[model samples]
Target: MPATENVHVWGDARPLYTYTRYIQNHFGERVQKLAVDAGLSCPHRTQGRLAGGCTYCNNNAFNPSYCTPSKTIRQQLQEGITFHANRYRRANRYLAYFQAYTNTYAGVDKLRALFEEALQCDGVSGIIIATRPDCLPESVVNYLSELAQRTYLFVELGAESSHDITLERIRRGHNARSTEEAVHVLRSAGIPLGLHLIWGLPDETPEMMLQTLHWAAGLDIQTLKFHQLQILRGADLAEAWQHTPEAFQLFGLDDYLEFLVPIVEHLRPDVAIERICAEAPPKYLLAPNWGLIRNDEILRRFEKMLLARNTWQGRCWRGEF
Candidate 1:
């Protein structure tokens, strides 16, 4: 017999979706751009050489040329929209995305000013903040709750893995427990959350990766993104990889799918799966050239695997093992 879809108490995949891309498909005629840069750095990295940033971090590695600090927060937003508007000509709405560094790593009052400035923008529709789990303060949570009540708001946490050892190996400076606690605290506020994870990390097996997905499924997050670990152009990881390449196990195209198939099955039915992978620019990528493949090709293979097994997302999560 075929398995039937179940309705979830937390409002599973069908009725309400958390992704901005998914929402744009339904309501808006044109998608808007939001850009925010508050001068924030990870606490681990702020001390300079002690903890340094994550082994795989270079803020400029992925930073768009459009994102510049000379401009105020509001000026950055206008510039981002202008760049997109010239091409689309019809998109009028925007969401202010606080992307660079750790957006929440500041005083509550300063954070409030940055957020409020974006909300006041004429075409701005909502806000999406990208920050590490450890950086989100109580004041930030309360401030965001009020904003969620008034306008669309969500937070993205860099909870990259469930493996504590991997966390230490990467010098993440925060544990899986910290991520869980942060998620729990913020969930009570009712703003949607987006969790970021990387598929290929050093010392993690397929089982470990699935465990991360299962853990994520238990959360109240609205969306999730899976990124393949890219050894970027200027990242500290690249230097390490040169000396001890065996420390990393970068996946070929097929090996990554092997890791992902069960992840799709085990992830919560309610979580909106956003990007399956990040496209690392060739010039900046020190390894893992498989990112050159398109997202659609990967999705097609994933869907094929699901159909072949006659299983879909949330299937394993909802059933007996």
Candidate 2:
């Protein structure tokens, strides 16, 4: 657990420790992340390894149209900058976000070349690499450690759930223990770490979801991203839901807000809350439609609820729940 002394001090109007605040504090200015596809494949979806991907994952749902592996890294970065220019006009600096598949699922030399390519791009300040925990072998971790020493780097692991049973149900090749071990390795290397969790998974009750948050809080990490499981059209979960919809506990927007408020209260104050919900393109999304509401709107509503209840992040971290 994080130190509790002065845990309640937010120093801002936001009720939770948001990633935006963390970025402003670290970079001294607003920094935008330009998502780039590295044309990488996951170990779980490879021919020799586990063939099927995660049941709830449809990568196309979250990826922007400009982000594709077909383009060069520099092309993607330039296009991404132009893509977000209007919305984040103040963002002069940017981070090259390798978000598609397992970014580190390659040889150290290849990974280094790709990352350096992005670093060489104009206006790019740093890099954020997202990959599966089991893919971070010692060789990759060592390379990332060296990279972190010179530039801003964040390694986000997709530890979708902390329960081994749920992990298996989703066909996640590795168990929760892989995430724990990866966290330890990354922390030892002095790498800033982030863990991603899916709130609504098959057979995961509200209590189980909270247990995953508690488990993640104990890890040596600097960030957390909570994504409500979305049943996308082409995902394995969608097929299953079609067969038996009652088995899945998909959250309506109101139920999600009610469930998420307590999660914010229980989250460790020092950990930056990167995201609270997932927004898939409506064309790809199958169930639990929130009706054209964007992520920013969802966040606004959540913060309002937090203030109305007079609660904030880490309110229950010291066993106050």
Q: Clashes in each model (backbone N, CA, C under 3 Å)?
A: 0, 0
Question: Across residues 102-216, which tens digit of lDDT does each residue of candidate 2 receive?
Answer: 9999999999999999999988999999999999888999999999999999999999989999999999888999999999999999899899999989889999999999999
* Residue pairs with clashing backbones, model 2: none
lDDT of 2: 0.89
The 0-to-1 C-alpha lDDT of every candidate, in the order given, reads: 0.76, 0.89
Error of 1 at 102 (Å): 0.6
lDDT of 1 by residue, 1-321 (tens): 123354332333232222443555534555565666766766768866456689888777666667777788788888888777765565767788888888888888988888898889878888889888988778888888888898888788999998899999888888999988888888888877889998888888888888888887777777898878888877888998988988888987787777776787677765777767767667888888785677767776766776677666665677332
Ten-residue stretch with the least lDDT total in model 1:
9-18
Question: RMSD in angstroms, candidate 2?
Answer: 2.6
